[model samples]
Target chain A: MNIQALKTYLNCDNGFLLSLVQKFVEELNDTTNKITLAWQNQNLTSIKLNAHKLLSSVKVMQLKELTLSLEKIEAGAASKHISSELEEDIKQLDIQVKKVINDLQLTIEELEANSPCI
Target chain B: MVFKCAIIDDDPFFTELINHYISQVDSIECCGIYHNPFDALNKVNFQEIDFLFLDIEMPEMNGLEFLKSLTTLPPTVFVSGKTTYGVDAFENNAIDYLYKPVSFARFSKCVNKIKAHFEHTRTNSQVKQQNIFIKHNGIHIRLAVDDIFVIRAHDNDVTLNTNVRSYKTHLRLKDIYDMLPLNDFMQVHRSFIVQLAKIDKVDGEIIEINGRTIPVSRTYLGELYERLKIK
Candidate 1:
């Protein structure tokens, strides 16, 4: 994660940045579950919407891998297909989001340990 | 003057990001941030806001539907997560369309556009307050409101007598009267609106202004006397 760039763009101190990333982690976990459920249900609309929403957070976090995966999932919904490939893409997105969430948690811990105000 | 703005979006994260952007700008103030359109409609005095940032997809009502329900709307910028709503936003007269994950630079550009729009509107309003345009001789003429003395109506057109010249235009006397400053102009009869400063004499039934005699109706004579500060 490019915490430096995100911090500069936000113009926020360490505390606000910590909280924002924490919120992102929470939202990421919830949205991943939503997209997975939507994909399993063959709900194209839900899949598309959740991916689009998650894309915003990933973009802001500068997570290029997750950004590309979310974009593909969003577009995949448009094809109205429930093929094995799209299912695999959804599976990969879930794994990547879980990994990112873990990394963000670590970043949060580091920030708290380093900054007394946070 | 600091411009007041509001944000209506379902996503708290997006709204918080925008609020931070607003705090960094010196010329803008965020008056309200709503997670839904329903609360915004009930709480916001739209007349006090210069512009708004709206998200297209919310649970209660989409941005387009919310805007359509209102008779008047401030300038709006559409913030959304997808590219699908661009044409719809254009049709609804959105000032700008921003896709999700907007950077500070992109948001700044939208704010600049809003500032320019408000500046242009303010300049035009100032001009309108001081002058009015009337069509005469197949051409439009700009007449200073201070120079006009009388508006007399014929069957189909009204003649505006100014200090420079009298121009006749096809308009109703009441319609023309509404355009003038109410404190300086008064309708004294069914067909006449005379500038209060130009009234030289207010006799029993006749009023004299600029070497011309106009009749005053009983309906307005008392008000005219009161306006002229005559007992």
Candidate 2:
């Protein structure tokens, strides 16, 4: 993801965007965990709801690939059973989220180090 | 003077984001931020707010539902992630609809709209030098300042009682006070402002004008006495 482009979209400074990114990462972790537990318990309703909520944040961050995967997972949870295709999509979403989280953290650290006060 | 505004949204992040955007603009001031629409209804004085920024998908009451519930609404702009709400938003007479995550350019466009709206209102108000133009329904009816006896404020509405007729308009008393000629008018009470020449009699605690008894609160009594040159 283009962190600079995201900051420009938000019309906020690096520190503020970093804070929002932190919140997004936390929410992503929580939602992924909820989806995993719901899938293990065969609770399709919870999986669908959690995926739907995550889709909003993912779209805000402009993560097209992850958003598409989450949309598919949410659709599957709504109508179809938790099959191998849905499982693969969920796994891919989880991987993408983790990678984004790592990239955001590195950006945050770089921003903090470059600040005059620091 | 900067126009005061309020934000109603359930999401803290979105509120913060909007607040940040508002801080960049010098002409607009964020008066209050409410996470709950119910709380906003109870707390915010709609009469004082010039504009509102609302989110569509809130927890307790959605923005559209809240807008529907209001009797007198300020100019509003809906900010949301869903593009499907654009039709419903305009149906309720929203000034503009902004999709999230709202960029600075989009937000600035909305700000320009607000500026143009207020500028137009100011220009219209200034056009009539001797007469006060009050919008009744959709048309601006010119009422001479000389005919107006008392300006009474109740809730969000203000009534201009003239010698021949009374015109009720949806405008704040303070806003009307600002528009009226200051030399000819004096606010004698928090909810009452009377034409200086229309004062029939000034009693100890009340003033009578054209058979209407208007109370004079202690807070404004001193200024009223000074303005009238009453010892």
Clashing pairs in 2: none
Query: Which candidate leads the pack in lDDT?
Result: 1
lDDT tens digits, residue span B1-231, model 1: 246789998777788889988887766789899988999889887865768899997765889989988888668899988789999988876778998888888888988888677656555545345688888888999998989999989988899999989999987675576577666888887788999999999888898998999998776777889999998
lDDT accuracy of residue B51 in candidate 2: 86
Docking class of 1: acceptable
For model 2, the docking class works out as acceptable
Interface RMSDs of the predictions, in order, are 1.8, 2.6
Tens digits of per-residue lDDT for model 2, B26-114: 66789899988999999898867888999887655789999988997678889876698999988876888988767788889989988
Top DockQ model: 1
Every candidate's lDDT: 0.83, 0.81
TM-score of 2: 0.63
